[model samples]
Target: MTKILLETLKGNPSDRVPFWFMRQAGRYLPEYREIRQNAPSFMDFCYNPDQATEVTLQPIRRYGMDGAILFADILVVPDGLGQKVWFEAGHGPKLTPVNTEETYAELSLNGFHDKVGNVYETVSRLSKELPEEVTLIGFAGAPWTVATYVIEGAGSKDHAAVRQMGYGNPELFGKILDLLVDATSEYLCAQIDAGANVVQIFDSWSAAIPEPYFHKWIIEPTREIVARVRAKHNETPIIGFPRLSGAMLETYVLETKVDGVSLDTGVPLDWARDSVQRHVCVQGNMDPHLVVSGGDAMVNEATRILDTLKGGSHIFNLGHGFVPQTPPENVALLSETIKNFRR
Candidate 1:
């Protein structure tokens, strides 16, 4: 069977636009919440292949989405690198900060594969469980974004410390990024070897990097990961989501050589169509707030996105992950709209 999502990523037009949301499997769904409660910890939930595989299939079972991303977190890379990573109930991820060259050197890739082996098992199980028509996407955080958590030890309001280090201590910061690049590339290649039909590298904090550092931090590492993965799995499709990269989006697409580019909410439709979509398959930009405000508002905005990118290879999706408050019915309506869209 032809997987519409993979075909679209290859710049091939499907009969209808393919669609999937960022956090398709999470707290928004009551089913996911019920399952989440069973796990002792969030990291445990991700590491358990049985629970992880079920959560991954939940969204697909409910919405029949074109793609099913693996149910895992980006911090798995840090944990695999031998750093301490954990999640707080109300607060988000908390990691033991790595600042000086000493702590950085302490991170070792010796047991990286052993640490994330369960994730690969989850991917393997998902491939067998999901309908062949639905694509299985595996992903990891880009070096810069993952570096932020490593340097700051948690999510930050301004990412000041990391930025200061990138500017002030380029050698130290560059070492962290280089290590991430090697580790991320290996992790992704392993996912493909296990069964992921496609992979995405999420650079959630790309916008925080100063323009001068964009080339070294954002573009270079991504290009290296892409090159490394392609060297191993030459036929597998790779999508790059450098969220809020602005003018650098074009440069990211050209330099990284990703098969597709995901556009965030801030990207303009016309600019994305003319510059980004024209070059590779385009995958997002819907505002998550509209999903919450459902009714004609949601339908109207989704329709406008479909109309804007209808002429090219496109995958309809939210610019970011869904918030916990999103009504499930609205997701149904949004999926209905995309399924019925015509050029």
Candidate 2:
């Protein structure tokens, strides 16, 4: 059976738009919370293929989404590189900072595959277990975004330190990005080998990048990874989500040569249709908050998104991940709305 998500990613005409959220298999679902409780730590949870597989399929079981993104975290790359990565109870991910050239040199790709072997196993199992029609997506943090965590140690409000490093220490920062490019290419290829039909590079911090460095930091590293992945798996589709890229979206799509581009909520609908969808498949731009509100408000916003992008290849999705407070019923309603929408 032809998977609609894969077909859409290939820019092929489909009977209807395929839909899936960024963090679809996550905290909002009670079932996921139950499974999460079983594991001692978040990293432990991710390392368990059985539990990971179960969580990955939970959202699909509930919503019948067209795609099932692998249940994994982007920090796995830094962890695989031998960084000390941990998650605190209320706080998110915490890492031992790699702020200098010496620390940067400490990151090695020697045991990368061994460190993340479980994730590949999860992909291998998911490929066999998922419904034939559901596209299995594998993803990793884009180098620049991942580097920020490595350099700054955790999420930051302004990304001041990393931005300053990018400007003042271009050479060192370039080395860090190069290391990620090599490691990330290997990691993504392993996912494809494990049967991922599509892969997405998530540059969640692209919005924080200064305009002058967009190409150097955002475009170049991504282009390198895409080129390397395509060299080996020419047929597997790649999606680039440079969130909050604004007018630079056109440049990103053209230079990186991604098969699809995921738009954040800030991207204007008409601009996306004319500037982006005209070039490649477009996924997203719906405000995730609407799902939290639900009812006619949710329906109206979703309807508008569907109506706006109806003219081209599109995937129904939130501008970002679903938050923990999002009502499960709202997800069901959104799914129903998309399944029922017609051009």
Candidate 3:
């Protein structure tokens, strides 16, 4: 059976809007937390095919979401390129800072597949293991977002370290972005070859960029990655999630030529339906916190999202992702609400 999400991405809406949430298989799900405890580190868990595949399937098994995103980190691209990466217990991902052209030069694509081949193995397993109707989504970080972590050596509130590098020395910054573009292209293509049905590039830090250089830093690398991936897998749908890019999203959609665009919470649904959905399939914009505090209010807002985007190609999903504090029952409720939504 052709997956509902895939069909939706092709601009064909079905009886019920195909639904999935970002970070669906995450800490909010107890099953995931149980599995996570057994693994020593986040990256280690991602590199382990068996564990990764199981976690990827967990949300699908529980909520019957139409999509199953690969369970891996965006930083995997850098880690594959030989940068030192580790996850702290509470703080999140940490990488050895790559601040210099020298450090960037040291990172090579040589033996990259050999290092993170297990992620592909996980994708390979998921392709065969997922329900026939479910779409298997493979993904990576966009160059700018991944570069932020590479320069900062961890998640940042302001990305000051990255700005210092980008502004003080754009030549060096360009090199980092270029390298990321090449590496990310290769990484995502490998995932598709390994049996992924689609891919999503997560530009989580895109909003950090100023408007003047948006095209230089955001659109250019993404367009290249989209082109690179399409060159290899012409039919594979690519979804670009430049979270919180606001009005620039229309520009991103047009220039990047992605098959779909995942809207962040801040994007107005009416604007997205008019500007974005007309161009490509749109997959989100619901505030995830609503689901966490599930009730009549959550269902009402979800209904509003449904009613708003009903006219064009739409996939029901959270604006971002579910938080760890979210109740699993709430997730189930939200899933059922999406499943039940109809025109």
Score each candidate by Cα lDDT.
0.94, 0.93, 0.91
Off by over 4 Å in 1: none
Per residue, candidate 3 scores C-alpha lDDT tens digits across 230-301 of 999999999999998877999999999999999899899888988888999998878989888899989999
Q: What TM-score does each of the candidates earn?
A: 0.99, 0.98, 0.98
The deviation in Å at residue 106 for candidate 3 is 1.5
Cα lDDT, model 1, residue 304:
95
* Model 2 residue-pair collision total: 0
- Candidate 2 global CA lDDT score: 0.93
List the candidates ranked by lDDT, beginning with the highest: 1, 2, 3
Question: Worst ten-residue run, lDDT, model 2?
Answer: 204-213
In model 3, where do residues sit more than 4 Å from their true spots? none
Q: Which candidate is the best by lDDT?
A: 1
Task: Please estimate how well model 1 matches the true structure, expressed as its whole-model Cα lDDT.
Answer: 0.94
